[model samples]
Target chain A: MTHHTASAEELEALARHARWLVLSTVADAGAGHIGGPLSQMDLLLALYFNHLRIDPSDPHRDDRDRFVLSKGHTAIGLYTVLALRGYFDPAELATFDHGDSRLQGHPDMRMLPGIDASTGSLGQGLSVAVGMALGARLQQRDFHTWVLLGDGEIEEGMVWEAAYAASRYGLDNVTAIVDRNGLQQYGWPAGASDRFDRRDPWAGKDVGAIFRGFGWDVIDIDGHDHAEIDRALETACGARGSAGRPTVILAETVKGKGVSFTEGTYRWHNGIATADQLAAARAELGQPETVGVAR
Target chain B: MIAQRQVWGETLVELGASDDRIVVVDGDLANSTKADLFAAAHPERFVEVGIAEQNMVGIAFGLSTLGYRPWLSTFGVFLTHRALDPIRMLVSQTGAAVRIAGAYSGLLNGRSGKTHQDVADLAIMRTMPGMTVLAPADEHEMRAAVRWAADHDGPLYLRIARDAVAPVFDIDTTWEDWAPRMLRDGGDITVVSTGVQTSRCVDAVRLLADRGIDARHIHVPMLKPLDEDRLAGLLGERVVTVEEHTMIGGLGGLVAEIVAARRSTQTVTRLGLADGWSESGPDAFLLDKYGLSASRIADRIVGVHSRPVGTPGV
Candidate 1:
């Protein structure tokens, strides 16, 4: 299979497009995640556009590298990226959170095409990815499985359990990317406020050290940087099975990257966007000044 | 006669010998759950998920998608309560083919006290949409249920007791069908039971026969897809349900729901543990205390039948 490495500039453009779509989609839907999706769009763009071995025409292709969005509330981001990747029509982003739309509040694999696993309840995707990686070994397929998790989502004990098992079985074909955005459902980010005693809302835990302690090959990268995201993912993909441990890329990200008003705050996790705020976000992303643009 | 979980472990060896796809995942209670037998026999296919029941279920659900027939075993309480959310989302929602052995259930685990005693296993399992809930009466039925679950796709929860039971049906009999099996027939009253409670019903039936009560006996191994039609046919306006579970949700609750929906007029009497926590005691002492023993079951049936107004005599 031939693969092309999208230039950092191209991937950055895609990420901006995804970010623009995330803002407009959530604003249109009136109920969708904003902060985590915005922070993680670059990584999503890097993996989906530049990396994931998937065909939009035949989304269920057997040899495709699988992806699981463990932090499922951010389906708006994944759905937009999947659309941009040609899994569905780019126009469908406008239908997000609509009563009849397949783009549910959580990522449902059964309802949507190209979704490897249905995950909404936190800290479960890594275990499923472990199984996918194990499946690769059992079936003798050389495909890798990637899972995107939130730093706060790691607070779940099941995450640790999966981390332990993945290492115990030496599932190197699995890669976990933690969107270390420093804010969770609670908005007070590490340095955003001192209410949490100078610690991130995710309990001041070391994301890189945690994965390394769980016997994974850990990588720290600037999540908003497409070049760094591309390099880290490529390194993890190349080191699969040869690394002797599951790889976890802890990408440090702002709570909201593109939009200054929503950036690095907990409120935007599911914060409703006013009309003016939505227009400001559009101006930031350089989209046409149209309210809910058709397509 | 043998312990149902003992038979479950042995059957895992039998199935594991023939089927390479069969894998057993345990939650550190393999010996108590009898999954250690599978672990020892086929270490390559067995997984010990430490003391984490939640991870055991998640790992097992993941393994199922990879063409593996996974049987996750632990005490009924943990599998039903500790990992229920995942079991619902991952296994039930996805409709994965995973066999769940909820072992050390009912009064059998009385020595472990209330925390381990599984009275609500059936009520919880029966509520799941795609869950095929089964509670075998004896070792033969347990073997057949395990085999059936292996072939039957989707999620299956097999609830089993820890104690060895007296065999009601021979192993040679066709133990495949899930419909409630009629062990004895009469028009006076129907006595439906499951697990070791079925053995108690058998003894009670013998005692009732001597008293000319002519009670019909039915063994309900399959609790969820219950044989409501057949049970209504033999119930004859009066039915007595026996189970070593909580009176709220186990066999008693299932029967009440089936009878209420199918035969609303039929008078159903339920006997099980009270709605209070139970302390540690001898297995026999606890059974009689809760009126689940053979003699008590017979006495309750006689007392109910002899009463002229047809009111329940607890």
Candidate 2:
């Protein structure tokens, strides 16, 4: 009930702040999954800052929409968004991944509020969300289950397994948004180089069609475009009540978005920024030059 | 006694009838895993998660968070290995209330070849942090353990056997006691065994009685959350541990650790399959080859009873 609707301009600002915070926290902690989180920040902002029906005052309400960061290595970004959303003090983002910090490399539901399921290992988060959506059906609750997964994680067979089960159950209440930057832990997978001259690295294949084949309501859109992201969110939320098919928002994102050197690259996916790299990223995000150096 | 898997399926149906939160998930092995009994009773609550064990575990973990007690069943081999990480993270790490009935475990899947046989399940389940591992001796204990598991506060793995077993204890036996149940009392040697091996030890007692030697047979139900005092009490002059598992981290390894730490003077002899795969055959032949038959167990206990005190046998 206390949600503030973010306009396109405000949503862009939120995305900027999220990207700045993600780079800052990873830079401070000396390590994190920077590329994927940067890729998914705008998608997260559209949901958390505007669309997601959650209560910061009462985080565990049964009827609230559930958001699971299945691409859980992106805790730096989600932790920042959660803090900005008032789940906790914003300053705690500095202590992420440090010794004795509640913000571990992966998200742990037991360690923090506003977290529905703890995840880090790829491919299982969607299944958790499927279970939640099915639970909402069985328990007669009117809440939504939104999961954010990574593109590389789709390689895991378990993701397809979850895809089949979600489709079988007709989980209209579940919406899975994939941060499809197209590169995994290592760079583009081996066969991609020979496939399409390495251009449109999903090998010129469509991720939306993949989900469509699995019987999901597919929405292919630019993840960084606030308007497209909002439209997909509205379309997904409109099918909320029951008997609706599950939706997969194929958000075409750039890995390491917002920072010039790291954008669309794999080098900064799992690492700490160097002094120069950190300064470059800050300047790109137009963040103030502060003394929070990478330790 | 009935088959542990049968008892598991029946108890699931009975539990599902009474508890609205009880939901059963099967991994395309409903007939083998015996979750079909629950399906018949409460089809709405029974979910066939196809052949995907990994997704089945994740789905169960999801349901547990929503105030529902999710019961999962699949072959021990696939459930423990195929979805091990998901079970560890979704269920074990968070201590979720996901009661997993690991069916067709141990060398009991004699005709199904090496792939179906899972002697390492006890070790794998035991190694997980905060996972409650239970391998009951008989159907009575299996039913008791299943009932206890339905209400057990956290993640639990109940190992079920493929074959039937004779009743080792009363119907009202307390499966959650975490202590070994003493079957026969004797002072010469303490023979601790679990799962179907416990019954073979009972058969071994008759052979020992004929040789003027006495044997104390103890049937342990809960492999993890072991009762330290009961284990210490059962560790007599000579200790013999037998299990339908490998000597790695099953009953034998667990008992040996306790004996070594608490009673250093006690000699511990372990009887189980050697570090190798079991070939396809009748369960009896495999048991005999592995030195788990009644005669082998009888001879083992006699050897331990006659050996000098604190003299360990390989």
| lDDT for each residue of candidate 2 in A45-121, tens digit (9 for 90 to 100) | 88988899998888888788888899888888888888888888888887888889888889999888888998988
Pairs of residues clashing in candidate 1: A187-A266, A190-A200
lDDT of each: 0.82, 0.83
Residue A262 displacement (Å), model 1:
1.7
- Candidate 1, residue B4: how far the Cα is off, in Å: 1.1
User: Could you give candidate 2's per-residue lDDT for residues B1-314 as a string of tens digits?
Assistant: 57889888998888888899999888998888889988989998888889899999889988888888898878888988888999988998888999877888898784897888888888899998899898888888888888888778888998889998767777877643767788899877888888877878888987998898777888888878877777788667788888888888888888888877874678788888889887888878877877888898888778777878768655
Tens-digit lDDT string for candidate 1 (B30-62): 998788899889988887777777777777777
Among all windows of 10 consecutive residues in model 2 chain B, the one with the lowest summed lDDT is B171-180
Error of 1 at B294 (Å): 1.2
Best by DockQ: 2
